[model samples]
Target: MFKVVICDDERIIREGLKQIIPWGDYHFNTIYTAKDGVEALSLIQQHQPELVITDIRMPRKNGVDLLNDIAHLDCNVIILSSYDDFEYMKAGIQHHVLDYLLKPVDHAQLKLF
Candidate 1:
């Protein structure tokens, strides 16, 4: 079993993902949620979850900064973005993210990742 952390500034997004995803089906045993990148980073450093799903435009520390910060960690990241910007996509590529899902994230798409 693995651990996963879901990070987003919005309460609905954080809670929705946590509840909607059938994490156990994907072999995830522990699930954690964070309100922003700052808290997410702390949780990442502490728990070292196998996976992280984070929003791009968060306060405190944006997804780009978080990606850079976790570049050395041995965890897979899936970015959640509301915008279809190339700059963000470029960053995700540079950091070797597992996948990037635009918001109103598609559950079927997420499962494929």
Candidate 2:
């Protein structure tokens, strides 16, 4: 079974994202969430989920920092951010992030994953 972890600072976005995906349909048995990068890193280490979707900016650690730590892992990475800055994309690129989603993420867009 595949596992997934989503990291974001906003409670609503976290909850909404959790609800948006039909994990069972995607063959995902476990879904986890973290409010900030600190907690996110801990979850990633503990669960080692196959997929990680993380926000670009958060209190503590930040996505770039987490990306640095997890870059060697086999899991797929997706970045979420409000910014369209090239530097953010560059950092994600350095870490092999597979996709980027703007805030207020569209469920359809995510479904494609």
In terms of TM-score, the best-performing candidate is 1
Q: What TM-score would each prediction reach against the true structure?
A: 0.96, 0.94
What are the clashing pairs of model 1? none
- What is candidate 1's lDDT per residue for 1-113, written digit by digit as tens? 89998999999999998888888889998999998899999999999999999999999999999999999999999999898899999999999998988889756779524
TM accuracy, model 1 = 0.96
* Model 2: ten consecutive residues of lowest lDDT: 104-113
Report the C-alpha lDDT of model 2 over 1-113, residue by residue, as the tens digit: 89989999988888888897877888888889999999988998999998998998999889899999887788999998888889999998888787888887776777425
lDDT of 2 at 64: 90
- The number of the candidate with the highest lDDT is 1
Query: Where is model 2 more than 4 Å wrong at Cα?
Result: 111-113
- lDDT value, residue 89 of candidate 2: 94
